[model samples]
Target: MKLVGLSRQIVLSMMAIALGVTLLVILTSYAFYFLWRIYWPEQACEDSWIPTGPEWVWMIGATICGLALAVVVAVNLSRRILVPLNSVADSIRRMAQGDLDARAVAGDRSLGEASQLADDFNALANQLQRVTEEQAFWNAAIAHELRTPVTILRGRLQGLAEGVFMPDESQFRSLLAQVEGLGRLIEDLRVVSLAESGHLHLQVREANLAAEANAVVDMVGDALQARGQRAILELDTQPVRCDPVRMRQALLALLDNVRRYAVPGQVRIQSHAKNGWCELSVEDDGPGVPEDFIPHAFTAFRRAEGARSGGSGLGLAVVAAIARAHGGHAECRKAAGGGTVFTLIWPDLPETGLPGSNRSGRA
Candidate 1:
């Protein structure tokens, strides 16, 4: 029914009912006038009221003309409103049936409201086309990324099993590592996609900027310890207003970047608050970014040459996206000790501090 054309029988039936009512009204009203004349006495002046045969015929003709006019009016109105609506309806149906090229074309003088609607419909169709193209590109890129690792693992396993190569533990471990890298890349891609697309539901709550940084600090504590590194938390303002989960994700991404780039014993988490906004900075002793590379760092799949960065190149991109989604930004600067300092600021504060108290989380 959605794909089919509009039902003409339904439309005509409605018009038939309307015409029938008009006929009934004309006949009943004139009939009453005729009966009234029959019951009343003739006028003293015959000129004043005459019940001639021709007058009756003229009155009957006029009634028929009025009824005909009423029917014409009803039919035109029904066609003007319903027919255009049906055309737009048909266009929608075709579009829903996967006809990407379908468009709802509206004729002018159609209440003008439907013209606006058709404009919206055409705009949506154009957007769908663009999205379809982008999705195709994204799929191709992912397939290429996946195939590289798979091909390597497959070749290595085949060689080992067929005795074409010696059963070396290091060789097998390398292959396994490649496979694991692919897996991590896929997962990180998924996470960044969801986070950037605003599909990751945020559990917004008040949390301590220092404490949140410290927790991520704790998670990486062992790895940093193994490298003779330590995390320092210095927050002048205790609590910051924002969602804990999302903010933590941003911080973790930054921390991961710092670990990959900075020297050991170079981690610092410092924060400051002024006006309504609070900012927390994560600085490290890593080499500062080249001036030209600073702007490109936040783009997905972008990395500096010789950076030796592990994980998907989505860390900084995700951090940027998450910050903007929360109505703020992530800023980069040179640390006091000459490492990179990334400050995540909260420009907007919720009226009620949610989930956790921002005041208590201060170190």
Candidate 2:
């Protein structure tokens, strides 16, 4: 009943048709024999009820016709079911061979599980294509970012070696700075990789959120002052369990982003408990991010038009990674007054009196 691994529906249909034809043949033959015996008793008394040659011919012909009909129906049904599956298999094969653009085309009549399978395959193909494109972009961006600092270091070293440039303190300091920048870029890439791969090392302990925020502000205070910018802190004293060093690193990244992108205005840092989460936010009163670019703001190597400085664009991405490692998340939004606000939220730790508790003063 099965032809070319056809669907169960087709197999069952063929079986039913064959069975019906067999019953019809048997009943019709017996009925004809009974009529012959009733009309001609002498033939019946001859003691042979076996089918004569002409009667056998009629039954064979009917059976052949019925089988032909069954064969036609089975073939047609198999075609209807197998054609789409074949197309899907071929498309998958092409995709496995690196043709990300290959896609399965389901026929208009395809329904039920076959249609769903086609839809799922197409969706997976689209996702793979997108990831491939993003990987290409990452490679290009990283190369460009590394090339600048490396080129500078190489040129400076060559000049010094050839006596074209003097080995003065200032010259050496500049070279050292370029080397440091390159090292930082490499380290940032490592951090992002670790975070994405769920291998980032975290030393979790109870720490005061306010103290951490103030420390971060103090760390970046000089830069803000040089830019003629003022930072305000409104931290709520709360003890949260997190890796203090990693948390500070995340805060520093956010501060660096503000320093690089935001205009000279009042920068606000706030931390407070909201709902079941503790939220830490950095807000500025300068030009805000564009609406269209907000979604990709945290992506590595992504920069807005206002980002003209020499940045590798991994600052916010690292922040996001750290937040996720802490069972939290980061978000960017337009600040109410102006400019943009970046928020990091983590689940609130249970109330406990730790060493850093009761320290609520702002910096």
Candidate 3:
């Protein structure tokens, strides 16, 4: 039923009940006065006795007027409270029935607690909708990303099985490369998923941040040389509390990104400690990212218009996840000397000398 009318009906019904009780009380008082007159006739005429009939009528009329005023107030108050409450209840029902967009009526008339309730519910609904959209997008993106590599692997293996392609060492190496790519992609996905769920495992300890960066640089040194590029270290010996394995993984991802897309020049790996924070960055020369795409550079499976097509587009996203898991974040920007720089920054927590630490010494 319409809440306004329902409120009015409720007020009137309650007023009717009150009026009936008032009449019954008046009749009972009149009967009691008659009984007193029969039992003790002299006291019936006492000045302090019950009022006369006209006075009784006046008192009853005043009481009815007061009740009428109370009905008006009650109706207005009930509408203010009940209308919005019903609206919220209806919205909740709609949302429970799978309407993520459903929202309560929140307007000037929705006053006090009702207004706050509507605002909170709308905020929750908006969050649920955004999360649902992101989940759907991730599902589709994961399937699309897996299909190409799986197709390549299947095609190669089938050809070999059917004797259509020679099983030579070169062919085997190609197959192995595809398998390795699949493995890396799967691991990247796992890291991202865990990070998103706030369960990414970390063996956090006091370690040398510069050492981790140097280790990644050393490991990828030969690969960059093969690609006609070299690494330049401007590292500082800075200690930080973090998971060494994950930190190395993030650094390697950044360097791999550089190796894949950066121009054939010096790739700089830098580390520094300032303002109670540690920064590890990989900078390259020339061919910077487009200005407009910088904001979304760390989003999963996102690529710039002119980016190389070989990457699975999860490297920077994985870097961001790793940074977040380390109680920090990742960012990308253009270097002053013209190139893209991706940096992982986190707090430099106070040193706690944990045992079995992977604390590589100063760079």
lDDT order of candidates, best first?
3, 2, 1
lDDT per residue as tens, model 3, 35-130: 778986876777846686645875676677667766776677667667667878999999999999898876434355666677788889899999
After superposition, candidate 3 runs with Cα above 4 Å error: 1-48, 108-110, 351-363
The root-mean-square deviation over C-alpha atoms between each candidate and the true structure, in angstroms, is 9.5, 6.3, 7.9
TM per candidate comes to 0.56, 0.82, 0.81
Better-scoring candidate (lDDT), 1 or 3 = 3
Q: Give model 1 RMSD, 1 decimal.
A: 9.5
User: Which candidate wins on TM-score?
Assistant: 2
Best by lDDT: 3
After superposing candidate 1, which stretches have Cα over 4 Å from the reference?
1-51, 71-76, 109-113, 123-131, 163-173, 193-237, 241-248, 252-271, 280-313, 324-363
Q: Poorest 10 consecutive residues of model 1 by lDDT?
A: 354-363
**Per-model lDDT:** 0.70, 0.79, 0.81
